[model samples]
Target: MTSQAADRPEQVASRRSKLTREREQEFFDAVLDQIRECGYDAVTMDGVAASTRCSKSTLYRQWKTKPQFVAAALRSNRCPRFAGIDTGSLAEDLREAARAAGGTSDKDQGLLQALGHAVMQDRELQQALREALVDPEINALRDILRRGVERGEVPADHPALEYIPAQMYGVLRARPVIEGEYADSDYLVRFVEAAVLPVLGLT
Candidate 1:
């Protein structure tokens, strides 16, 4: 029954893949919702499992801990908005990216707050967060800058073009902690107009 044995492995693999995908989605939704409703210190794998109708054992088996699980959650939520920005100018691009970065999502914000202390202690989780959320978004913006260079909208030698994404992300991430303020559109717009565009000589 070699054929039967091979078929069984394939079937099991497929089933496991499906289960993993479903559970991961459930876990991410549960984590974000729980973090939004409760503070970072208050969220737990047990709580997430109960909310998502999954076993705590399953979550532990997959992620090992809440920090690892949250790291995975952050990675899953990354979306690039590069294609939406087009004002036919470098100023428009920076402004567009900053504005987009500033609009804070409640669930995502809560997730970040919840992961704060955990991220400090967990290197793997921090790397995962960078890989999942930060890197892709930054890479997309970098691509935008590269395009601007090709179009001659921004010079290849411009410092602002090279550093705009960092400025955008740094402020977007740190503004809340720095000023105890939400990362709103107004702050991002001001940053773009005041600091970012000025560096680019766009204003």
Candidate 2:
């Protein structure tokens, strides 16, 4: 066989990999948008393939099941939104974090709400949700608290330190359930100022 013939298989695989990568985001976006529009149960592999203009077999080739597909999509969209927030003060850092979270709260909360009990049944989906949405912000918030302790703004052993993440996350998830409204930017900022700041003994 000629060298060209020998290399054709490798070239074909490389091109296939590139094509998969290029279409990956399109698939992810379609599934997420569908989840947002219709709850998780309503989002199917066939629906996603139709939305993305790909074959159902193509989706199955990429991910074997709807849960696997959604989990992969969530993992692919991982963005550490609260990373790199430092303002020389824990109060300001938290305020900035609230602003950052509030910016995407509606969409994120909607996804979580849409996923709802479906995530409870699937460990992979649960992990993907936490990795994509929950863990990064919690880690970043803890880092902010650690910096506060180092700066002597808050004592290292302060009782409230451990609960900060819960408090922040709780409010975001709770406000809508309580009042039928999202915890938007202004509401989050005020929460940071009135509730969170006071707990930390900050102005």
Candidate 3:
């Protein structure tokens, strides 16, 4: 056979490698879905392998442990929906931001709820989840609020401007469990008026 004909096998192998990578991603997503459905404590690498039709060793090779695998999965799924918070007014910007952040995402919120105990027990998991899911969004929201100060919509010295994102997110994350109500648009607006807007002197 010609050398060009021999290269056909190489091309086929490369295409197979691409499919392998895609299947690996599918396995990871399936594991995350099982965790969300059954809770983290209920999931096992062996179980994931059985469900995904892969070897348990494959999962271990890809991610050292369940925590490591879950952390990577959480990182992979993080989305930056709050990157466009410009509504031309601080109150409106904040309202929009709250809308973007109000509801828990299906994967994220479920993973967070399930992994809370696991994370508390594992320092690596705690750090990984915080860096992956929490820190980037928090920092970006801070920057959005800082721009509001620059635009003079909020006073440079406004305490609320500095703390609003944290308060809003903290409440949004906690209030459902603590108060049994979702952080809907109306509730978020009320929070802004009673807690945030007054501090910024807008109310």
How would you encode candidate 3's per-residue C-alpha lDDT over 75-140 as one tens digit per residue? 766676577778777777777776676554434666777776888998877887887778877886
TM-score of each: 0.79, 0.91, 0.80
Output the number of the TM-score-best candidate: 2
Report lDDT per candidate. Answer: 0.74, 0.91, 0.74
lDDT of 2 by residue, 23-133 (tens): 899999899999989999999888998888989988886789999999998998889878989999999999999999899999999999999999999999999999998
Please give the lDDT score for candidate 2. Answer: 0.91
Better of 2 and 3 by lDDT: 2
What would the per-residue lDDT of candidate 1 be over residues 1-203, giving only the tens digit for each residue? 68657687658646653356766787897786777678657988989988888889888867788877887786776666554676777777777776676665334455677677777888987887777667877887887788778887768998567677787778766876888776777777888898877776667
> In model 2, how large is the Cα lDDT of residue 143?
96
Worst 10 residues of 2 by lDDT: 13-22
User: How many backbone clashes does every candidate have?
Assistant: 0, 0, 0
Q: Pick the candidate with the highest lDDT.
A: 2
Q: How accurate is candidate 3 locally (lDDT)?
A: 0.74
